[model samples]
Target chain A: MKQLVIHPERCTGCMQCELACSFVQTGTFQPSVSVIKVHVFDEQASMAPYTCFQCEEAWCMTACPVNAITIDNVIGAKVVLSEVCVGCKLCTIACPFGTIFYNPESNKAFKCNLCGGDPACAHACPTAAIEYEDSETKDWVGPWAERLNESFLTALAGEPS
Target chain B: MIAGWVGKVLKVDLSARTHEVQELNLRWARDFIGGRGLGARYLYELLQDPTIDPLSPDNVLIFATGPLTGTNASCGARYMVVTKGALTNCITTSNSGGHFGPELKFAGYDLLIVAGRAASPVYLWLCDGEVELRDASGVWGKGVWDTDDMLREEVGVPDARIASIGQAGENLVRFAAVMNDKHRAAGRSGVGAVMGSKNLKAVVVKGSGSIPVADQASFLRSQWKKKASLRDSKGRQNFTQLGTSSTLMPINAIGALPTHNFLQTVFDGAEKISGERINDDYVVAHKACFACTIACGRVSKISDEAGGRFLLHTSPRNWKMAGEGPEYESMFGFGPEVGVDDPEAIIAAHWLCNDYGMDPISAGATIGAAFELSQEGVLNGTEGVLEWGDAGKMLQLLEDTAFRRGLGDEIAEGSKRMGEKFGRPGVAMVSKGQEFAAYDGRAMQGRGLSYATSNRGACHLKAEVLRADYKDPGHEGKAGQVARTENQISALDSSGLCLFLNSGATYDDYIAEFNSATGMDLSMDDFVTAGERIWNLERLFNLRAGITPADDTLPKRMLEDPIPTGPRKGMVSKLGEMLPEYYDLRGWPEGIPSQEKLAELGLEAIA
Candidate 1:
């Protein structure tokens, strides 16, 4: 499974992620439509983007009395169905991360659905701060290589190749 | 059904605390395009009082958004404030990019026209379709940052964008700007002073709305294509990495950088305060305005020499010493132009300008003039106020100017006035009362011509033909280029697009996007003609304001003094050679637009 990994420090707070997400989800270019929220902390000169974590036992899914929220088997995303949604405030209150947002325009609750495994935000980010990485991939620079082979190549290059 | 417009405007009377929604003038909209052009048209038409004072409540302030503003258009994050500037006493159209413009557009209005004086300090709170003037007494006399912080809590939405003035505006500092998103500013003219005069502290807005475009699908595709192009652009990349300070080293190398009150062409301390050094030493992070792909905004933290001098600086993030800027202009203004090399102090001064709500370029240039006067001993009235290389004194003067204290009072009137007050009119490095930005006009012919002809006095962004001006060895064909570029820039500025984005997008791309967003079948001639019409209208406004053809001139220093050092040595502004050609190209009767030219550009009524 690939997951969106966000390094907030690397983010320029351009909100390209929000715009990309909004266009994919709502067929519009509104920041409020985007599931991903970039909270600006101007005084500190920092910005942190927040989105649904897809908790193992999703609070929004469990708290939905109308059964509008459900987990997708393919992507493990806790998705919201606007048709089934009653615009109830319960799921929003139950969510711990405050990632689940209710849209006034649609009168439904919505959160990040990972764009069905190909999130537009990760693709749109100019800095690659938001990356759709294979979860199993190890944290290393350049292409992954075995330690002995990498050491041999590094030795051959006479520098950290 | 113009696709991009919200189709309405809010006309607010501060005196009555009342607002009325009216249908946007379609004829005017069709003619002016939007933003600066549209705003200028509104100001020119609506301002009926013959003897309206700039700081008086009669002088209207128009906050307008372009058709592409708040749309998915690349760099479509700008809004402009148009008014008669208190500093320059000319038609001032100040442009700024941030969340505010987009938010204003999202709040369902194309323009906000503010007029009349309030009985007390108040702020306009706008949400969706609702608008009201709320009491701002608590936020009164506060810095821009503090006001924004308090207002957000009051509004109970952290995401709401606020544009506010600081102590400088409250004190009616002539060069005060309306600071938005904390640091992003319409930071050139004295628009803030007009706001102050009206007793309006800020405008708070939050919009949970979507833009209804002509065709969403095609618009999205167009935006995507543009974004892809921007991603690959080399200029965009350099801007993101180096910020506007990217030009600092190059200009310094060419001897075009304004140094020591425009006396020297090159600076001894230029390298110390150069972009490379600042980027390496201080820039801790990068940020951006709303929807900006090129995140040229810098976040720098400076630890004063003896540890933290500014503790918990009351910034939004509550950082001890973090702020946006010391961008190229402010850096030059406070650094080499004032003969100071302290980058940290420049950053500190930049932070002060943001907080206090003043244009750093004008303020710093004004201070540079003061320093020059102090050195000459001709400043009998104001002595011992400033000295060369005195970063500490410059900071003090900045604060004083914001607060309207002592010699800071003199500095607040700007360089032109400050120079005269001290008995040296020749020392003032200004064009038509406003201080010029970085770049020696002598070394850059186009800049000299642009400065002289700029409607809003001595602004570089009016038509920054820096490359053509800098590299061109002679003054041939410069006038036509400057005039054409100025008209183009005027058109571009009227659109809710950043001129910086022109690096990646071509003129055709701009035309396509404008046509796409507006659903208007505007040909290239129509677009360019509209720009010419808008430029002429602005000129008419300035002309009506009593600025004559004689006012079209470079500063004495640029016209008389030769470049003393660096690449373009002994070169002076050959404005005399270019002025005639420029007038001819503009179809102007001796610098004043001819009636035939005005009618050709569809300004027959005004003509």
Candidate 2:
């Protein structure tokens, strides 16, 4: 299955992905409402655009009280049916990645639906930091998280990592 | 509500501790568009008495964003700070690109007009359209980097964008700058000094609003096309790969580096501080501003051996590992202009300018003027204190200038004042009390004209004549070209777009984006006409403020003293030859706009 992959090293923190994602989701250029977000580490001069990894476990789907979240057979991606959503943020709390967002204006949970197959973020990224390619579902953040952990430990120890 | 503009103007009177949200004037928005032009219009309206001191409470400070600001358009991240300049005593519009402008727009304000001085040091905090004037004592004396971190933590908004001044601004240095995003600067013409005079330390914004577009489909297509063109352009590739320092070697080769306070037109040590050197030795990563496809920002680190050099009494921050710049302008100012060749030293000074919130161009030029005065034995009791190529002294002077200590006090007054005090005014290579940029007038004749007639004193960004000047180093037909280019640039500056995009995109591209985003059916000619209107309005402001036709001139060195050595040796800027033609082209008799010209631009009522 095709999955969205992020190369954090390539991100320059321009927020173009967020701009595109928000336009697709909110019908206007609003980064605050974007499901995908770019986290900037100014001191370290680093940035990364992160979104839902689309894990096979589908924790948000399982955590939903109602059947508002359903899997699309064509794309095998979880989609939010806002019409049935009761404005409860149970799924937002249940997600480990914190990718799913609760929109106050719309009062609905919105996450990266991969644009049903061709994600707008992946397409909008100028540096190709975010890419959609066919692969088995894997933990994309594991390596980045480990590097960040190493840096933190190094700073604490007063030594270079 | 307008499609592109948020349609709200936030007016704050610090002295009265009051605030009001006024509707943005739709008529002014259509005429000036926004940013620099709109800001100028507002200033013209507010400051009816043009002779008021720039640092006085009467001088209003405006922070304006164009209609395209905060949008998904490529490089749509510019904002303008317009006020009477403390340095030049002329109407000044300083432009910057970062997340601040877009964030301001997202906060639903098209303009933030700051009038009256605060009773004490204060910072303005705008959170989703709500306003607060908080005590800034905690971060009042701090550097820009420290202030940025502290304010973000204090506001407790992780995503807040802050525009703040530092010690230089606090000390009222004539060329102090307003720095944002920690590294991006609305740098030039002493806007920060004005902010400092108002007792305003910083303006923090956290926005959660949307920018509605008039034609989403058309805007998207036009913006993408611009992005793709930039992606394919060699200029963008060079900027991304090497950053702006790429221009150093070429400018140096053209005999326009202006070394040793313009005593020489070229620097022999140019190769050592070139962009290739920085990229090969120091660059840690590349950076980009908000929505910018051309990631020209350089994030570099000091070498381990040289890291201990140029130490300051500041808390540890990014300078230990990585920081942005030594851009082309900074490299020129801190490197060849001051005669320092060490890339590490240039990087250190550049970083110091960013942290201290100072304009490196004027700062380094002021130091260069001092060096020349010392060399000429004009400055009293300066035996071993000042000299060319003294990197250690250069760094020390930068710190001293920021804090207004010793010789730094005189230097902080700017080169023009410093030279006059030392009884050698000719040593100051300045125009209209502001120091010149990197290029030497002798080698680039058209640039000479641009510098002489620049609305905000010696500025290079106001006009586009480099290609013509570089192609033919003569005083022929430059006046008409410069007048035309200035109008186009005025329009571009007001459009909330990066001028660096001119490397790949044209005015047509900008016009297309503007038309689609704002739903305005303006042709290329109409857009250029808007720019002409803005240019004339600025000229009127300057004339009223007592910057006469005589002020439209270069320094004595640029006009009379020929370059002593280099390819263009024995060449002088022919201002006398071009001024009349330029005035004629501008329809300004003796540099004063005629009544008919003002009427044509629909400014008869204002005039």
Candidate 1 per-residue lDDT, tens place, B153-203, comes to 999988899899998898999999999988889987799999999999999
lDDT of 2 by residue, B1-607 (tens): 4578988999999989999999999889899988999999999999999899999999999999999998988889999999999999999999998899999999989999999999999999998868999999999999999999999999999899999999999999999999999899989999999999999999999998999999989999998888889889988898789877888888888787899899998899999999999999988888888988888888988875565677743522557857899798889888888899999989888999999999999999998888888778766653365778998888888888999887889999999999889888888888888899999987998899999999999998999988898778888999889999999999989989988988787777898899999988899899889999999999989988989989988888998888998888899999899989999998998788999999999999998
Interface RMSD of each: 1.8, 1.0
RMSD of each: 5.3, 1.9
TM-score of chain A of 2: 0.85
In candidate 2, the residue pairs with backbone N, CA or C atoms under 3 Å apart (3 or more residues apart, or in different chains) clash, namely none
* Docking quality (DockQ) for each candidate: 0.47, 0.77
Residue range A19-118, candidate 2, lDDT tens digits: 9998997778899988899998887789988888887788999999998999878776788999999879999999988988888878998888889898
The 10 consecutive residues of candidate 2 chain B with the worst lDDT sum are: B309-318
Off by over 4 Å in 1: A104-107, A137-161, B306-321, B381-385
The 10-residue segment with the lowest total lDDT in model 1 chain B: B306-315
